[model samples]
Target: MDPIVEVVALILGFVGWVMVGVALPNRYWKVSTVDGSVITTSTIYENLWMSCATDSTGVHNCREFPSLLALNGYIQASRALMIAAILLGTFGLVGSLVGIKCSKAGGENYILKGRIAGTAGVLFILQGLCTMVSVSWYAFNITQDFFDPFYPGTKYEIGEGLYIGWCSSVLAIAGGVCLACSCKAGTKEKYPLRYHDRGTAYSGAAPSRSAAASTYERNAYV
Candidate 1:
């Protein structure tokens, strides 16, 4: 694997995992008025596991939501997917680090290192898919709620966390692709001459009578 490609993938995957972790605990919405102005008197933010409200005076309080079993289907699914992505990303990061050619953990076996790197790339791709699905589903729900005309509940706008989640997912997917590409066959040149052919060439022998007759026939035809 090219060292540059390996390094680039490692960096992107690490940063994406960090971003996802940061976004997971953040609130996905901001309580706002119908006029689109933020309600500073009481600001609310929410995540998969909890919701928090901050007062105008900077005082903040958070409360955990109901158990996972009681949560809505989308919420439950998103939570599960995000958590799974995080775990997979963690393992992928470790595997990538060990498998990179710049690292000595996987030893001097180039083929084994390539396999490990390819596996890690697959893991990263899976993580990215999980995160993308979770974020997109949650964002869809938010958009639906925001546009619903019949709902009398407080109007909410998309929060920063969701944007971060989208970016992180994209990065993870791109990194995985780069890492996978690095597992392709290298450009190193192969031996041009076969061993047996080299031996035959080295062991010179006199031409047979059949070869001389064939040469004479070819000359006569020409």
Candidate 2:
């Protein structure tokens, strides 16, 4: 196995950590909203009740449970996850490159190397999908839209940034895979040492000076 593939696998592992540990949850919060303002309630020990006054009664009530901030946090986490996924894809490309090189280097068969490379390709494709969704979310403020659906209000969307980030990630992974595979193909050569054994050559051939050695042995004995 090429050292590069190991490095790439580590990088991919990092990406996975970032997504599961940070990003996915953030995005979820970003795209969601918690009911508040119109809903508020004061709680008593061991007891809680919700009451709202209608227009006819002329009484107002509030309930507090859902937090918008928390929902926004989820959105942020989701974006982070998308970024991580893209980063992971980049590593996949690197793995492919390593596999290709190994195949060509004669350490492993081309078929095995190619399979590894193909796995990386699939990861890149998945990353592309994630990037698309992330970019869309950033540009359209999908999170905010999700929260309000119909409300028209000023909000921020980092669509361009998200799209660019995703693109770079995808490119890195794809390029790495291609490079590794090509390297493997180009270096493919089964060395005579490991394959067809030139037994004498490998084991050490009989000395060309054998006749001279015999004469010297006789003289020494005399």
Candidate 3:
């Protein structure tokens, strides 16, 4: 793998994982009331784990939600998925660091290192998917709630955390893909056209020998 590409991917994955961590604890996934004109009293901001209300006087009151079992399905699922992604991303980061060609921690086995890097790439991809799914699901619910006319509650608008989650997901996926491509390139370099050239040479030799044998037989007959 090219050292530059490996380093770029590693950086992207690390940054993305950090962003995910930052986003998870943030209470900015949605905000109460779509219109800023109705700032009469206070505003509420919510996330997977908690909700916070800011009064007109700038006093902020925050409240954590109930236990996981008591939360709604979407909230529970999002929380679980984000946690899983974080764990997987952490493991993937270790693998990536050890497997990167620029690193000296994984011994001198280049092939093994490449394999480990590829595995890390797969893990990163999975982590990205988990984050994407969680964010998308949460966004869908937010949109649904916002558009529902029958719902009597204040409509919430998408928040900064959702945007951050999206960016993190993209970064994770892109980094994983780059690492995977690097692994493929390394594999190709290891066995560049050796088998194909051997097969072509063998085939060419066989045809020529057969042609010479036929000529000799014809001459013998004549």
Q: What digit string (tens of lDDT, one per residue) describes model 3 on residues 1-222?
A: 887888888888888899899889888999886463744588899999888999889999999886878888999999999999899899989999999898998998999999999988888888889999999999999899888889777789889998999998999998888888898898898675888888899999999999999999999999
lDDT rank order: 3, 1, 2
**Per-residue lDDT of candidate 1, residues 111-194 (tens digit):** 888888888888889888999999889878877878898878776777888888888899898889889888764422223446
Off by over 4 Å in 1: 28-40, 185-222
Candidates 2 and 3, the one with greater TM-score:
3
Q: What lDDT score is found at residue 59 in candidate 1?
A: 92
- Give the Cα lDDT of each candidate: 0.83, 0.47, 0.89
**How high is each candidate's TM-score?**
0.81, 0.38, 0.86
Candidate number achieving the greatest lDDT relative to the actual structure: 3
Instruction: Check candidate 1 and list the clashing pairs.
Output: 27-46
In model 2, which runs have C-alpha deviations exceeding 4 angstroms?
Answer: 1-69, 73-77, 83-87, 101-106, 142-153, 157-159, 169-222
Candidate 2 matches the true fold with a TM-score of 0.38
Give lDDT for model 3: 0.89
Best by TM-score: 3
